[model samples]
Target chain A: MRGCADVRALLGDEAVYEAAAAEAFPEYNKAHLVSLELPDRSGDIIITTYGELDKNNYLDPRTAQVATVNHIKQNCTELRPAADEELPSAYIEEFRSALDVELSKYVGEAYPKGVCAVYCTSGKDIEGPGANFGFAAVISAARRSPQNFCNGSWRSIWTLEFSDESQFVEIKGKIQVGAHYFEEGNVQLDTNIDYKYSTILQSAEDCAVSVTNIIRHHESEYLSSLEESYLNLSDATFKDLRRKLPVTRTLFAWHNTLALSLTRDLAKELAIGK
Target chain B: MEAAMDLVRRMPPGSTETALNALLSLLPDHSIDLLSQVDLPLQVCMDKESLKEYILCEYNRDADSYRSPWSNKYEPPLEDGTVPSEDMRNLEIEANEVFSVYRDQYYEGGISSVYIWEDEDKGFIACFLIKKDGQGKRGYMQIGSWDAIHVIQVGPEEEGAAHYCLNSTVMLSLTTDNKQSGTFNLSGSIRRQMSMTLAVADGHLVNMGKMIEEMEGKLRNSLDQVYFGKTKEMVCTLRPPPEVLNMRLPDR
Candidate 1:
C-alpha cells in the first residue's frame, strides 16, 4: 500500500482533503475502520462505511469533529465476538416466562370496563438476532359515561410492539398503538349528537339535554372542518379524529357527573353529617 | 359547463364493459312505481340511443341525493348551482344533440321489440324486451350473437292481493374476446351471464310451487268466464291457408 504522506503530496491538499470518494470513484466506493488499539480502547471497534458524503451534511466542522472525538472515546475496550447468534429454544422460553411473571402482577386489577391481551408466536420462519425477541402488549380501559354511570361506555386500547435487546444488540422493529371507544350494536349518537335517531331510544333522555348544550360549544369549528376536505393532515388523522369525537362527548358527560357528585358530597359535609 | 366538466373529470375512467353494464341496468328500480302510474292507454316508445341518453340524464339528476351503495364519497348537494361554465354549457348542448340523434336513429332503424296489453278489469299489464346485440368481424375469426327475452305480467287489483310464483333459471358466463390482426393490432371482449328463480307473494318471497298451485284455480276460473263458451271462429283471429292447416301436428 502507498504511504498516506506520499499520496497526499502527489495530490494537492484540497484534493486529498476531500473526505468523500475524492471524485475518482464517484460511482461506487467504500471505506471501513478497524481499530486495533486506539487511545482508550481495550478491544476493537469496527464499522463498515458505504456511500460518499456522510448523510448529515452539517457544514460546521466543529460538530463533526466533536462526534468523531466522542466515537473514539466510546470505542470498545475489550475484544468480543458479535453476540448475534440464533436464540435457542431454552432462551426463548425463558424470555416468555419472564414476560408472564411481569404481567401476572396485574391479574387482580379491575378490568370489567375492558381487558386487553396480546400473544406472540415464533418458529423457524423468523429467527435471528433482532427477530429472536418479539412480543406485543395491549391495554384497554373502560370508563362509564358520568351522566348515569351506564349511559355509555368509553373504551380505549393501546397496543405496543415491544422488543427485548439487552446489551449491544442491533434491534429493528415497530410499535403501534390504537384506541377505540365504540363497538358494534352500541348506542350510536349522530356524528354530531344534536340530531337524535327515532329508531333508538336515548339511554338517558336527560343525558342528551345536557350533552347537546355541551356539544354546541364544539360544533362550529369541528363540523365546518368536517364539511370540507382541505384538512391540514392526512386521511388517517381525519379518521382518528372522527373516532375520537364520540369519546370526547362521553368523557364530557362523565366529567359533569363527577362534578355533580362532588358538589352533593360537599353539601353533606357542610351540613355537619346531618 | 365548468361544473359538468369537473364532474366528468372526477369520475374514474371506465371501460367499455362498465359502460355496457350501465346501459343495461340504466333504469332505476324506484322508477318502476312512477312508470306504473302512467295512464293505462299510454304508448311509450324508445330507441337504443334515446334510451341511453334518458338513462344518463336521470342518473345525473339523482346522483347528488342518492346514496349509492357502490360509492364511498357522499356527493354534495347542488340545489342552487347555476350554469356558469361555458365549457359545461357547451358540453350540455353537445350531449343533448348526441342523445337526440341516437334516439332518432333507434326510432327509425331499431326493432320494435316491446309489447303491452291492458285490461281495465285487471290491475296492470306490463311487457318489455331485454336484448343484447353483439356483432364483430375479424379477418380470421368472426363472431355474432343476439340474446333476447320478453316478459309479460299482470298486476293484482287494488281491492284484492294475490300470490304470484315465478320460477326461472339463468346461466351466467364471464368471457373475454381477443383479436389480433398483425403484429400490432389486438383487442379483447368480455361477457357476463346470470340466471335465478324468484317467487313473490304479497310483496315477499315465498315457496314457488305452493303459490303456483294456489293461483292455478283462480286463473282457470277467469279463463272459463272469458273464453269457455266462445265459438272457435269468434275467438280465433288469424287463419292459415287450408294446405298449411292440413299439415300433421308434431308429437308432444
Candidate 2:
C-alpha cells in the first residue's frame, strides 16, 4: 500500500484533494453523493474525480487508487443501452413498447409510413437533480410501449421507404412527446394529427367503394325478393341470424359483399328488440 | 401545349396506379322501369363493388356501409423488421380473393383490368369478361381449372358480412318510384368458351354437370351483386341511414 502523501506525490491529480478530506470524514463520504447530469444528445461525463480532488486521502487506505481510477474513468460512461436489455438503469424497452403498441392500430386503417417518430419528454416520479432518470426513463417507456390495432393479427404493418428520387411524399412531420410527467397513474398522450389520405389511398378507396356499392345494389334486391317470398310464411318471424343452410345461392359465392349487405338489411327490418 | 404540360405535371412519379372514380349502380329498383329508357348508356370504368348500402337498397341484404371494412379495429400492427414486397404477380392471392380473381380474369375477359391504389386514391378499371359458354351460344362463362383463380379486392367488407341469418334468404326484390316510363328486360348471355383448351378441359371434368349449373348460377348471382353494389353508391350520394346501410354513420 502507498501513503497518501506518497501516492499524491507519485501521480498527481488536483482532484485527489477531496479524496483526502473525505477520508478524514469517513462516516460522511462524498463518493456516492454528488449529482450526475447527462446531456440531451451525447457527450455526458459520467466519471468525475471532484470528490477525490477535495480530499487528500480519498484513495489512500486502498493502494489500488491509480489503477482503479484509470479503469473507472475508462468504463464509467452512463448506462444508456443500445437495445432493449436488462441493465443497471435503462428504459429503452419500456419506451419501445409504448410506441409500438400505439402504432399497431394503424395496420390496415392507415399505412405505417404515414406515421412519424417523436421524442417523449414527460413523466412523473422522476428522481434527483440530474433529471436524467426522469425524462429519459419515461421516454424509453413510451417508445417501447405496444400499440394495439383494432384489426388484430390478421392485418399487418406496411412501410414505404423514403426515396428522394420518387415524387411520393416520403418525408413528413412526426409527432413526439417529450419528458411527460403524469400525476395520475395513466400516461395520457394529448396529441392530434392532421392528415389526409395520400393519393394512393384515395384511388384504392374509390375502387373499393365503387365495387362495394355495386355489390350492395344487387344484394339488396335479392334480399327484398326473399322477404316477399317469406310473405307466405304464417309466422316466419324467427330472427335466427346465424342459420347456415346449404345456401342455394342465387348469386355466386363470388359476390360476398352482396350477400352480407342483404343480410344486414333484413336484420334491420326484423329489428327484433334485443 | 398548356394542357399537355398540365397533364405531365399532374402525373405522379414512378407510379403506374392512379385513382379514378365513376358513378355506380346507385339507382333504386323502381328505376328498373327506366332500364330501357336510358339504354344502359353508362359505360363502366370498373365493375361496381357491391357495397352494403347498395345491397340493402336493392337486394334485401344490408352490407353495413360503403367504407372499406379495414379499420383500426380490424387492422393489426405489422411485425417488426417488416419489408413491404413489390406488387407481386402470381403470389397466389388468398381464399378471400375468389370473387375478385374471378372478376379479374373471367369478368374482365383478359388480364388487363385492375383495381390499384397509388396516391391515397384507389381506382378500378371496371371490367368483367366471360367467354361464351360450352353449348357455344348460351354465353355462359367457360369454367376451367383457371377458374379457381379469383382475385380479391382486398378490402374490409368482403371478408365478413352477417348474411341475412344465412340460408333464410328466399328471393331478393327491388323497388323504385314512378314518373318513369320504360320496359325492363335482360337477355340471357351467349357465353361461349374463350379458348378451345378451356372448352376441352371443362368438357372432360368430373364435376362437368355441377360445373355448368354452378357457373350459370354464379353468373346471375354476380350480376345481382354488381347491380346492388351500384345501388349502395347511389344511396351515399343521396342520404344514408345507419339502419338502411347497416352500421351507424361514422362519428361526424
Candidate 3:
C-alpha cells in the first residue's frame, strides 16, 4: 500500500539525515569540498552516487531503495511508480518491456526479425547519479537471404543514466550494421558500418521515438551506403579475376623466361656429362 | 614495356636465377611464390575446336531440348509444338553469327551461342552467350558472359500503341590459374527491368532490337560503374599496394 507519496516522504527524511551528518562531520565535508575541485575526480563525481552517499554515511539500505524508486519514477514514464514489495531491478524490467513494445512495432515491417533486451547493475556497479543505478537497452534486427546465402543485421544499444544533479537523463547510443555472404569455393563478402551518439533528454516520453529515428536514419543513410560499397567491391573483385592485367598490356614474358630457364638446365646437364 | 625493360637493365650479368629473382621482385609476394616454383620454359596450348565443343556440352548439360547458355533447361515452345518455329530457330542462328563476330573483335578468339523462343501469346525471350579461354606459357584463363532478355506484351495503353515489359539479366564468370601461382575465380549476376510503349504498326523486331541494345548498354555500364569500379576502389582500401622490393645491394 506504500504509494509514490511514501517514497517522497522517505527521500525527505534522507535529505534531513544528510544535512545532520554534514554538520556533525565538518572535516569529512571539507574533504568532499576539496575533492570536488580536483579535475580528475570530476567525472567520477557524476557517476559515483554510492561513493558520495557512503562518505555521508547517512543512507541506510531502505532509504537508498526508496530514493532509487523515486528517482526512476520521476524521470522515466515507461514504468509505474514502484510498489513497496517490488525491487528496484523489477522497475528496470518493467521499463524494458514497455520500450520493447514500442520497438516491436518496427519488426516484420522495417526489419525481418528483431530482439530487444535490457541489462542493469546497482549499488557498487552503478556508474551514474540518482539511485546508484544504470541500465542499457539493446535492440537488434536482421534481414536474411537464404537464396543468396547471405544475411544482414543491425543493432543499436542505448545506455541510460538519470542524474539528480543535472535533472536530466544521459543516453549514449551505438548503432552497427553488418552483412555477410559466402558461397563455397566461389566468393565470400563481409561488410559493416557503425556510429555512436550521446544525447541528453529532459524527459523519457521521446526516448523510444528517438531510438527508432536513429535506426531509420542509420538504415536509410549509412546502411544503404555500405551496401552500395559492397556491390562495388564485389564487382571489382570479379573484374580482377576476369582480367588480371589491363587489356592494353601484352602478355607477360612467360615463354621467354621458360626458354632461358631451360637453357640453364641444359648447360648444367652438359657440364655434368663432361 | 618500358617498366619491364627498365627492370631487365637493372639486372646484373649473373645466372638466370639472378635474373628471375629480379623479375620476381616486381610482383606481389603471392605471385612471386608461385612463379618461383614453376619449371622454366613452360608451354601451353588450347585447341579451338575442342574448346568450342566443351563449352557447348557444358551449356547443354541436363537439358532435354535446345538449352540457352543462360538457362539450365530448355523452355517449352508456345502452342502445340515440340520444337521452336523455323523463324525463331533461324533468328538464333543469325544471333550466333553476330555474337561470334563480336567475340573475335573483343576476345580475339572464343565461342558464342544464342537462343530465342516465343512466350505464349505475349512476346519473346532471347539469350546470348559468349565464352573465351586462353592458355599461356604458365597460366590459363576462362571467361564467359550470358545475357537474357524477356519481352512480355501488356495490353495497349492507348490507341495504336502497345505496352511491353522488358526484363533482362546479365551473368558473368571468370576463372584463372597460374601453374606457379594461385588460382582466382569469380561469378555474379545482375538484372534490370524496363517498360516501353510503341506504335503497334512499328516493326516489333526493330522496337525489340532498340530496346535490347539500350538495355544491354545500360546494364553493362551499371556493372562497370557499380560493381567493377566500386570493387576496385574498395580493394585498394582493403589492401594498399606494397612498396616495391629493393633488389639492389645498399652501399656500405
Candidate 4:
C-alpha cells in the first residue's frame, strides 16, 4: 500500500507543488489534475497542490502546499474469501438483482423519457469446470425534431462478469452520445471505463455514479457546445445551402427540344399560306 | 423539332392537344424561327394521361387494406375477412366531405378526397388529397397537387390526462408551362412529428382535427416561402436579370 508521502517523493517536490497550486486555482493551473497508476496496477492516485507567487516580484519561487488528494483502488480482492471459495449460483443471482436495483435509481432520475433494462445469464462452459456469469444494465433515451431535421440519442451500458477460466471479476461500462442533422452532419461521442473488482455491490454503485455523471456532463456542457458550433458553421456557409442544378446543363437542353416542335408547326403553316 | 412534331401529331386529339396545336398555328414566322433554335417542348398530350393514371394508382393503392400507406391498426382480412369496417367507411365519408370544403377554400377549382383508417387499438390515420389541372389559351397549362397524411397514436390516459403522438407529411407539387417562357416545376415534401400531453378531455377526433388544421396552414406558408422566395433567389443565381443580360452589348 503506497502512502501520500511515497507518491509525493516519486512525483518530486516541484511537480507536487505545481499540482497543489492547480487545486487551489483551477484556472491558473493549466495542467489540470494528473493521475498516476501505481506500478503494481492496484490503483490510481490523483494529487492537486497549490502555490502563491508575489504579484510585485518577477522572480519568486513560492512555497508549495497540498490542496487535495484522491486515491482509487482498482483491485478489490477482499470481496471474496481467502479460501478458494466457489461463488454459488444463488449469490450470483442476488448480485444481479442488486445491480439492477442500484442502477434503476439513477436511470429514472437522469432521463425522463428514458428506458432501463437489466439482463443476466449464467451457464457452465463446455470446456470449463466452473460456471460463468454475466450481468448487464442499460439505459437509453432519444428525441427528434418534429420534421426529423435533427435528432439526438444517448445510451449507457454497464456490465459485470467472470469467465470460468479467470479468477478475477471484470467490470466495464460505456456511454455513447450522438446527434444527427439533415443539413449539417453527425456528432458522436463515446467513453469507456473498466476496472477489476471482486465485489459486485461496489462495482454496481461505482458504475451508477459514473454513468450519471457522464449523462449530466453531456446534458449540461457537450450538447450545448455542439449546438452552438453547428449553428455557427451553418451560418458561415448559408450561401452554399442554395439548391444546385440536378442535371448537367447540356442534358437539360433535351427538355427544350419539345418547344422546337411547336415552332416547326408554325413554319409549316406559313409555307402553306405563301 | 420534326420528331417532336410527329410525336404530337400522332397523339389522340384531346383538349390539351387541341389547345397546343392552336397555339402553334398562331405563332408568327420570326418567333417560330427563333423558338425552333431552342430544343424544348411545351406540354405534351401524353403527360396529362400519365399524370391522371399516376394519381389514380396512388388512390387505389391507399384503398387496399394490405397496401395502406399508413400504419394499420387491425391486421388485414379482419375476422370476417373484410378490408374496412363500417366505422372506418363512415369516417372516410365524413373526412372526404370536410376536406372537399377545405380544398375549395384554398384552390380555384380542384378535386379532393380523404381516407381514414384505424391505426391500431390506440388511434387512427387520415390522408387528404387535392389535385387541380388547368389549361388556358396560348398553350399555357398548370397542374397543382397536394397530399397531407396524418397519423395519430394515443397513449394510455392517466387521471384525465391524455397523450397523443402526431406524425404528418405534407407534399405539394406545381407544374406550369408557357408558350414563350418554357416550363417551371416545383415539388417538395416536409414531414413532422409532435407529441402532446394534455389535461383537457377533448375527444381524439377534435384534437386530430385541430392539429390537421394548424398543420395545413403551416404547410401552405412553408410552400409559399420556399416556392416564391427561395425559387426567386435560386433563379437569380442561375441567370442574371434582363438588365445584366445585355450589359456587354455596345451601341451598334
Candidate 1 per-residue C-alpha lDDT over A1-274 given as tens digits, one digit per residue, 9 for 90 to 100: 1223333333335454354224422221112122222223322222212101232110111011111212222232332221223222444434434433343223112222323222233331343434433333222222333232112221111112223343221212111111111111011111112112111112223322322232222222332322221122112221221112222332123213334445655885989777
**Model 1 spans with C-alpha error above 4 angstroms:** A1-90, A104-110, A123-131, A139-274, B1-252
C-alpha lDDT (0 to 100) for residue A70 of candidate 3: 18
User: Please, what are the lDDT tens digits per residue for candidate 3 over residues A43-84?
Assistant: 111112222233322111221221111121111112122243
Q: What are the TM-scores, per candidate, against the unseen true structure?
A: 0.17, 0.15, 0.31, 0.31
iRMS per model, in Å, is 37.9, 26.5, 23.4, 27.0
Q: For candidate 2, what is the DockQ?
A: 0.01
Off by over 4 Å in 4: A1-274, B1-93, B119-121, B131-141, B156-161, B198-202, B242-252
Please name the candidate that would achieve the greatest DockQ relative to the true structure: 3
lDDT of 1 by residue, B82-191 (tens): 22144333333332333222222221211222222333654222222222212212121122212112222334434444323232111111111222111110111111
lDDT (Cα, tens digit) per residue for candidate 2, span A124-173: 23221223221111000111112210000101111222122342312121
lDDT (10s digit) by residue, model 4, range B1-252:
342332222222123236344335544433454343221212111113223211221222322322221222222333332345667666564455444444444443455545555666545555555554443122222543444555556665578876777766554444443332223344444566777876546444455556655665555555444333343332222222335435534642
Q: Could you tell which candidate, 3 or 4, scores higher by DockQ? A: 3
Q: Where does candidate 2 stray beyond 4 Å?
A: A1-120, A123-274, B1-252
Give residue A252's error in model 1 in angstroms.
Answer: 29
Model 1 accuracy (lDDT, Cα): 0.25
Lowest summed lDDT window (length 10), candidate 3 chain B: B240-249
lDDT per residue as tens, model 2, B1-252: 222222212222111012011001222332343322211111112213432111011111123221111110111222332211233211111211332333333223222121112122231111111121111112221221111111122212222321110010111111111112111111111121211112222111111222333443453343233332232222222223225444543632
Candidate 4 lDDT over A48-154, as tens digits, reads 22111121111000111111222232211211111212222444535445555555565554454554544443441223335566655555555545263444445
